[model samples]
Target: MKPHTIKYAFWGAAFGICFPLIATFFELWMSDVSLSIANVIHAHSTQPLLWIIDSAPFILGIVASFAGKKQDKLQELNTHQESIIREKTESLQKRNMILENEIELRKRISVELEAAKIEADSARQAEEKFLANMSHEIRTPLNGIVGFTRLMLDTEIDDQQQEYLQSVMRTSNHLVAIINDILELSKIKAGQIDFEMRPICSNEFFAGVMNTLILAGKDKGLSMNVSLHTSLPEAFIGDTTRLSQVLLNLINNAIKFTSKGSVTLSARMFDADFGTRLRLEVQDTGIGIPADKLESIFNDFQQAESSTTRLYGGTGLGLTISKKIIELLGGKIGVDSTLGEGSVFWVEIPCAACDRPESHAEVIRNQAEPKSLNAKILLAEDNEMNRLLAKSVFEKWTQDVEIDYAFNGKEAIEMLMEKDYDIILMDLQMPEMDGFTATRFIRTEMEAPKRDIPIIALTADVMSVERKKAFAVGMNRYITKPFKPEELISEICLCIERA
Candidate 1:
C-alpha cells in the first residue's frame, strides 16, 4: 500500500519476469529450436515447470512488499526514540542550571552575613574602649577635687564655707556613683560580670553594709534598722561583693524615698530542694509606688510616675541594675507597695550554709589600728594636682614618712634604679611608659629586694579586666581614684607590714 512498498514490488516483479523469459530462451537454444518469441511461448505452454515459473513474479512481489513495510516501521521507531532522548537531555541541563543558580545565591548570602557579624563585633569593641578612656579622664580630675575638698573641710573655716564644701562633696560623690552605675550596667549587658563563691559571715556582712549607709539615713533624721532571723546561718557561700552591692542599692533606695518614717533591712533563710535560700527585704515608710505601676519600675530608666524623676532627681537605673545582678546570681527580685502607706522590695538567692571562716576574724582584728608607716615611698603619678594632694595627705599623717615623686613610669623606673625604696605607689596610665610595663620590668628584670617591693595600683580605671591585669603584673593592691586618705594610709601601712 505504501509508495516504498510499491516500488520494491515493481522491481521484484520485473526481475522475476526477466528470469523466466531468459530460462525459456536458454532451453530453446539448447534443444536447437528457433530462438524466437513463438518458439519461447510454445516451450512455456508445453512444460509444467514453465507454468510454475510464470507465477514467480506475483509471489516475489508480495514478499518484497512485506519486507519493505517492516523496514519502514523500524525507521519510524528509531526516529521516535531519538526525539525522546533529545528532550530528556535538555530537561536535565535546565535542572542543573537552576540548581547552580540556587547554590550561588546561598554562597552570597553567607558571605554577607559573615561580613555583618565582623562589623558589629568591631563596633562593640570600639565602644568599650571609648568608655574606658572616658572613665579614666573623668575620675582623674574628680579625685583631686574630692581630696582637696576633704582637706579644706578639716581646716578652720566659717560655717557658710563648711556648708558649701559639704554640698560640693555630696554632689561630687553623687556624680561618681552615677558613673559607677553606668559602667556596671555596661558590663552586665556585655556579659562580663563574674561572681565569686566564698564564705560570707551574715552578721559581719550586714554590719559592714549598715555602718556605711546608716549615716545617710541618720543625717536625714530617720532611723535605720537591721534584723536577722535566728534561724539564719552564721555564714554562707556566696559572692560577698555582689551581695553587698544589691543590698546597698536596696537600702539606699529605701532611705531616699522615705522622708519621715524609719527604714528596716531584714534577712531570713529557708530550706529548698536545691540548697539553702536567703531572702532579704527592705521596707520603707514613704511615698509609695502606685498599684498599677509597681511591676514596671524595675525596667531600665523607668520609674513609677513620670514626675518622680523631676522630684527625686535620679537616673532611675538603680532598681534595673539590681534586678539584673540578682538574676545573674540565679535569684529573683520583686516589689510590693500600696499607694499611700509604704513599699517593700525583696530578693531571694540560693546559698549553701558554711562554717564561719577564721580568716575573716583575723582580717577584722588586723584592721583595728594600722601601725605608723615610717618608710621611704616612691609615688609615680602624671597628674600635678594628684601629686600635691598625696603630698598633703602624707604630711598630715606623720613627719617620719619620706615621699619621693616621679612624674611618669619611666621616671619611677629610673628612680628605682638609683635608690632603694620601701614601696611603689604606681599609676597605671602615664606617658613614655605605663605602670604595667614598668611593673613587669621590675618583677622580671630587677634584683631581689626591689623586685620584691610592694607595688600598689592607684588608678582611676575600674574595669574588671584592668584590675585582673594589674594583679597579673604583680601589683599588691588595686585602689580606685577618689579614694579616702585614711583608706590609702591604711593600705600603705598594711603593705609595709606585710613586706
Candidate 2:
C-alpha cells in the first residue's frame, strides 16, 4: 500500500466517526433533546465508529510492511549489480594485461628481426670488399710473373728453358682463370655484368673457340668434332664474347672430364617471329652427372660432388657463370646425362641474322698482329716489377720506341706537363693521387693537347663499376692486369690512331 492510500483510509475513518455523532445529534434535536459537548462525546462512542478507528492502525501497518519489503528488494538488487560490476572490471583488467604483454613480445621480435637484417647486410658488404681487395692483390703480382714469362718465352732459349717457361705461363693462366671465375660469379650475383652485342660470323666464332681449346683436348687424347645443321645461319648478331665464353666453358668442361671418347659441339637454328633461335649443344663421353645433381651444378660454387672438385681442379664457378651469361642474353641452359654414359649441356638463344655474310678478308684483318711501333709512351705504375716488365715488353715488341716512367699519378701529371707523349698508360691505384683524379684533372684542368692525350687505364680492378669509373673519369681505354703484351700494344696503337 502507498502513503496516499493510507492517508485516504485515515480520513475515511474520521468521517465515519463524525457522521455517526452528527446523526445522533440530529435524532436528539428532532426529539427535542439538549445538544452539548458531553452529549456529542457520548454519541461518538458507537460500535461502527470504534470498528473504523481500530482498522486504521492495521491498514497503516500493512502499508508500512509493503513499503519496507519494496526497499529491501531494491537494496538486494543494488548489491547484486555491484558484485557483477566488480567481476567485469577484474576480467577487463586481466584482458588488458594479456594484451599489453603480447604487444611487448611482438615489439621484441620486430627488433630482433631488424638486427638480424642489419648483421646480414654488413656481412655481405664485408664479403664483397674482401673479394675486391684479393682480386687486386693477386693480380698485381701475377701481372709481373706472366709478363716476364712471356718476355722470356720470346727470347732465344734451350728446349728445357722453353718448357719451363711454358709450364709457368700455363699455370699463371690457370690462376687468372680462377680469379676471373670468382669475380664473374660475384658480378652475376650483383647483377652488374653488361653484354656487348655485335655481329659474329658463326663459322669464324666456332673456329676460333675450337682453335683455342683443341690442343687441351688433344693433350687428353680426345677427338673434338663439330656438327652444323644446314638451316643454321652463317652469321648472327649477339654478344660474341659471352657466347664464346659459354662455348669454351662447355667444351673445356667436357674435355677436362672425358677420358677417351669424342667431344662434339653441335648447332642448329629454328625460325622465330623475332629472328632465329639457335640451339648449341656440347656432348662428351665424360664422367656423367647424377640426375639429382645436374641442376645443382649450375649454382655458384657448387659441383656434382666434393670428390669432383678435388679431382677436376676447378672453382666450380665456370658452369654457373656460363649459365648466368646465357640467361643475360635471353637464353636457357640445361643438361642431359646418364650415370655410366656421357653428359650433354645445351643452350638456346634468340639471335638476329646479319644482313650481310661475314667476309674472310675481315677475318684476316682481325687475326693480323700489331706491327712494330715507333712512338713515345708514358707508363705510370707504382710497382717496380710491373714497370720493368712493361718496359721490357715494349722494347722487345718495337724498335726506336722511347718510353718514360712515372711511379704514381702525380708524377705522371708532372711528366705530362713537361712533355707530350703519344700515349699515356695510367694506373688506377697509387699512394698520393689515384688515376681517376689524375685523369679528370688532365681532361678538365690541363691545356688542349695534354688534356686531349690518349689515356688508357691499366689496373688490376676488373669490376664493372671500376671500368665504368675509368671511362667516366675520361679514360680512353681500360686494360686489366695480367694482360698480354700483344693486347696492350694493340690497345695503345688503337688509342693513338683514334686520337
Quick one: best lDDT, which candidate?
1
What TM value does model 1 have? 0.78
For model 2, the run of ten residues with the poorest summed lDDT: 361-370
Error at 58, model 2, angstroms? 22
* Residues 1-499 of candidate 1: C-alpha lDDT, one tens digit per residue: 7666887888888877886887787789777998877888789888888788888888888888787777677767787888888888898889889889988988998898889888877876777777788889999999999999999999999999999999999999988998888888878987989998999889989888888899999999888999999978999898988989998998998888888788898999998888788999999998999988988999988888889888876778899999999999999999989877889999999878899978633442123332356879999999999999999988877777788999888899999999999899999999999999999999999999988999999999998889999999999999999999888887887888899
Q: In candidate 2, how many Å is residue 261 off? A: 2.4
- Model 1 misplacement above 4 A: 1-106, 227-231, 270-276, 356-359, 364-371
Model 1: clashing residue pairs? none
lDDT of 2 by residue, 405-496 (tens): 99888999999999979999999998898899889999999989888999999999988888999999999999999998878877877787
TM-score versus the correct structure, for each prediction: 0.78, 0.74
Name the weakest run of 10 consecutive residues (lDDT summed) in model 1: 361-370
Scored by lDDT, model 1 comes in at 0.88
Candidate 1 residue-wise lDDT at 274: 86
Where does model 2 exceed 4 Å of error?
A: 1-121, 196-208, 230-238, 269-278, 327-331, 349-371
